[model samples]
Target: MTDELRSAALESKAWPYEEARKLLKRYPDGKPGGAPVLFETGYGPSGLPHIGTFNEVLRTTMVRNAFHTLSDLPTRLIAFSDDMDGLRKVPDNVPNGDMLREHLGKPLTRIPDPFGKFDSFAAHNNAMLRDFLDRYGFDYEFASSTDYYASGRFDDAIRGVLRHWQGVMDVMLPTLRAERRATYSPVLPVSPKSGVVLQVPVEVVDAEAGTIAFQDEGERIVQSALGGLSKLQWKVDWAMRWVALGVDYEMAGKDLIDSVTQSSKIARVLGGRPPEGFNYEMFLDDKGEKISKSKGNGLSIEQWLTYGPEESLAFYIYREPKKAKQLHMGVIPRAVDDYWQFRGNYAGQAVKEKLGNPVHHVHDGKLPDGTLPVTFGLLLNLVGVMGEGATREQVWAYLANYVADATPAAYPELDRLIGHALAYHRDHIAPTLKRRAPAGVEVAALERLDAELAALPEEASAEDIQNIVYEIGKSRFGEEGGFAELRDWFKALYETLLGSSQGPRMGSFIRLYGVANTRALIAEALAAA
Candidate 1:
């Protein structure tokens, strides 16, 4: 690392840098001969991987990348899947509900695949998680709870939980209500007969021997806690995984705050330190309710990518992670535009400023060259004006006219964005359009704007057209009224002419759409009135 970059990274206040600093403080001397810092992210394979899964790994990677700049220590990210977890309830979103219903209380790895692929339900979901991570080219290792348990990789940690059974219970019991406390045990034994992961309480017969006695179907049963014979409850399981895998860092959603606290205490009981991490607020749906994998209320990873670039999705995940943001179709266009805006600003930024810039983190310090000539918002408006049947060829024709030398080869990002804008307009914008006829002062303003636009030269710049529109609005409305009147004038233009309450800058839109076309649009609005 350059001395300049190292110095700037140490002072950067970006969240990723802040998180990296926490790790640096933990290992001031850099991990004894440069052992790689281990970063972990947990996945419950009860359902298919969703946007939340993508967000956690992406944010964790940003911090991991930040740490690479601050310290020379190598890093390893492990995406752990808790597939040994029992299927408590059928997920609402998946297919073959009847098949999953029959497998409740069994380990997820033992349940039949609902999708008719892979060996088990957990296997199917784990493959999806891997594919999703691989699609984004994330650097990480994959670990499965069932594989670890069955292969004896987790034997030491499992035995540690056995030795500290009471200690683990003491930390967990208080948090549960009276009804739950009565039946709660740190150890959950999988029934040898029924193959169900029994949640009933167990009596520890021998800690050193790893033997536990529990009743099953009115029959006495003795089982060893080691290997795949048993598994810890989720809280204890989480702490055990941290200890077993030597995880240095991990993060979770805000809803897991209490769970983190309870698990941290259990980590100490198992003679290990809890991993350093933070709790980010959860994503909400359009209605402002917390998004759920089961309910499937918000945009999925697949859905977001269909309408926006992957970098935009990464940009969205990188910004203000602590602050809750709504995940929906409406947020996609702005995210795409904001990502390009930051990327465009990256070239001129100083090292210190670049460290704080989100694009640096989004691209892992290598900012993509070239700027998007057209903003995504303007493309959406272009679609709005061109109507629903607009094809890529038609859009490209207009773009080629507005921007000489433009082509799919020269501006590939814009080409992809054009497709995205068409999809977005078809699904979201077209359904919500509410064009109205100009009324009162709006009619006169529209006539004057149209007349002025007609007289302008074909080479009139966006700035020149903007000045004319501004002067007309000021002469007719701004001088006689406050800011509200001028604002409403623009709002009227958007509603009556564009069929939306908000739109791209009028001058930019006019230049791109052709002044003649815009004049015809204004005349159409006037005729409607």
Candidate 2:
């Protein structure tokens, strides 16, 4: 580790460590009844699981890992799915849309699976949540709302909330609009006859008896607070989940900060302490709008894993998690590169240094041994040079010339990185790598630049070649206004060489692509120009 980073590590205001300290203070000795420190992250299974949802769980896990370093108390993280909640509308992506539409207002567990793979839509999404988590080897207990409610696991918590219904009302009612306040009830009864969650006024709440009496389509139904007879409102459910699970800590997106505050009030009313948590800013899409699963604008879990390694996504979740970061296909390469720069160097670092790096938290203490042989952006450029769908053998060929003896067997990640780079190039890079005949001035400069490459030393290092490329590119045009003129010349070189207005750091790229290959590429581009 660098002396500067090691020095910063001593006093780094890292979030994970800060959150860990807060979590230890909350538990005092983990939690009541000898239960381990419980950290829960909730998911609304109304749509396919997205990267945003995964971020919630992964970020919580990061904290959990951080907490382990602070104390020896056994801890558990729950990946809770609100699957029992009614499916108000069909997701556009699911199959059998008409079948799902008919089940509107019915619990997701009651509706048939749109894909016919699971018993119900909720089960399928829950399975997906589990599968993704398991695929990444997350250590978390899966808690399904359907199972929790149906099995009467939350029966006591449900009854407690009802007993303190007025307190819950005071916390929730103020947040609702005037029209909403008139009809709002924390509990929404599931009609036995119609099998739909009825949104109606509560005629009577027999809190002591744990029953709710409400009118549903002219029928007066008295439903038990136990056995999934009723589901709590969003805020109420959040509170109840914390109370029932005995959550000591958790984290959420900023959009839920208001709801978490309201839930904290409801939790106190329900006679349990609220979990300690931080509300992070939302992830913006490419358009700078908040990413939504319903809107289908955010990166899907499949698309993210398809184009990049899971660790890259982990790096994204750990990187500036509190900031409102932009997530898009364009953001993958930097994340991929970050894996090497940060986590790659984590193993040998001092304890204080590791504290500053989230790699320890992201990997849960068992950090990977080494880094990637090359940067992902360089690989993307090479993929473009190698053409789309380039096989592993072919990629390794260029890679061997670039980085000696580079093999997938030696670098385990390279096996996946190889295919992922090709796909990423085709999907995200190739379009930008579109060929164009350089403009009149650009053509003349690059033609001169090509001739300079031929005069380079045969044994020149990447740095040496890079310096030569820089000088050639910068001075191709007369140096007028120094920095801006150099920038314009570099811009011309990018357009001529990369066929794009921007590119990877040039010197390293020229070195990695091999001086010979880079020279040939420049000559070919100039000839075409």
Top lDDT: which candidate number? 1
lDDT of each: 0.89, 0.80
User: Which portions of model 2 miss their true places by more than 4 Å?
Assistant: 1-12, 344-349, 477-484
lDDT of 2 by residue, 123-173 (tens): 888898888899888899998898988898988888888788788889888
Provide the TM-score for each candidate, comma-separated.
0.97, 0.93
> Ten-residue segment with the worst summed lDDT in candidate 2?
1-10
Off-target runs (Cα >4 Å) in candidate 1 are 32-34, 478-484
